[model samples]
Target: MTAPTLRGAAAFVQQVRAAEQHLSGADPVMAAVIERHGPCTLGATRRDPFHTLCASIISQQLSSKAADTIQARLMAGIGAGRRITPPLLLAASHEELRGYGLSTAKARWLRALGEAAAAGTLDFRALGRLDDEAAIAVLDALPGIGRWTAEMFLMFALNRIDLFAMDDVGLRRGVAMLYNRGRPLSDARTLKITRRWAPYRTIASWYLWRVADPVNEIWV
Candidate 1:
């Protein structure tokens, strides 16, 4: 199936409100979170999939500020006249990429992703035509892309409405706080609890992340 049609901000806000209403009816615990958090700011920011994936790789095990610093350096190194295309990335040397603060493993992964793009093995344009599971599978097949990273692509890039990153520490913590009385939920329990939020779980996940760490901005 093709991806869901992208909506403008106004339309998306209305959609989120509707989802919240549905969630409130389905789960009282989550309802209280919505009530307390007021409105969610889970708007999608469209990005080139390749670049976004590369950014995801760059962000692994790093803080948001550090990731931002590395990404800025990478963009500068790629130069102003050129776009951050797969070919440009493929042409960049390990030394150059490492200079931008990329670890050897990450630099290798980025290059491999670039090669896949150049060879048409990973087509960004066709991603929207895939179902969520298929899209996640495709992304997860990449060298450095894991299930969590792929789920993130679905949430932030394709704006998929139903995905839940069950392994995410923050989401688990938030679930524990809201439902388990401030103790972290086991992965199995988290999965079962999140089932009720289906179709709007992405929105629910956003709120959970917020509740887990209200002070820190989650960039990944």
Candidate 2:
């Protein structure tokens, strides 16, 4: 089966090959993961920046399943086209938005995002031009978006290859399980271990996420 299209995904095969080779050689633990997983087809997606950001906001504290369910309901509520564009969100009344299973706060966040997009303050393309930290800072300034969310947007939406969210539960778990052998993970230790996969950490992350089930894969 084909992979789901991810935003800012690799268009050049050379880089991906280099990433895999780097990870394989850098850490034996990651090498085992890559050998088992075969390839890193990080979840396929084709969402635009604004749409991806909206999804990220909805996903803030919810499980992937819960977030997907609410987003589905919201898109269905919007119309048959199923596009969550700024204009569509801006056109909906706040009450109408909440009725789609979003919390009152989430509704406001959606409105804020919409307002940003409509006002030209949220330029998706411009984000690509900024370095990861600067771009993350820009996104962090937005309501409801934090370092983690901005990192995600940069990694997935902007298709940056080097970012690694050290604080992410999954990455932390992956590190502990594969390298530490169930020992407690400290921030400094985690940084030391993961930095070896640097410059290709995102790809390394994909393999790490696969550690629990090398035979089957899911983006979460």
Q: Which numbered prediction scores highest in TM-score against the true structure? A: 2
Q: Cα-based RMSD of the predictions, in order?
A: 2.5, 3.8
**Residue-wise lDDT of candidate 2 within 1-220, one digit each (tens)?**
1112433244534566789899989888888888877866653454478887898888888977788898998888877264689988888889988998899999999999999999989887677788888898999999989999888777666667888897688778888888789666999999998899989888887776677445433353
The positional error of residue 89 in candidate 2, measured at the CA in angstroms, is 1.0
Model 1 lDDT on a 0 to 1 scale? 0.82
lDDT of each: 0.82, 0.78
Pick out the ten consecutive residues of candidate 1 with the lowest summed lDDT: 1-10
Task: In candidate 1, list every pair of residues with a backbone clash.
Answer: none
Query: TM-score for each prediction?
Result: 0.88, 0.89
Candidate 1 local lDDT, residue 38 = 80
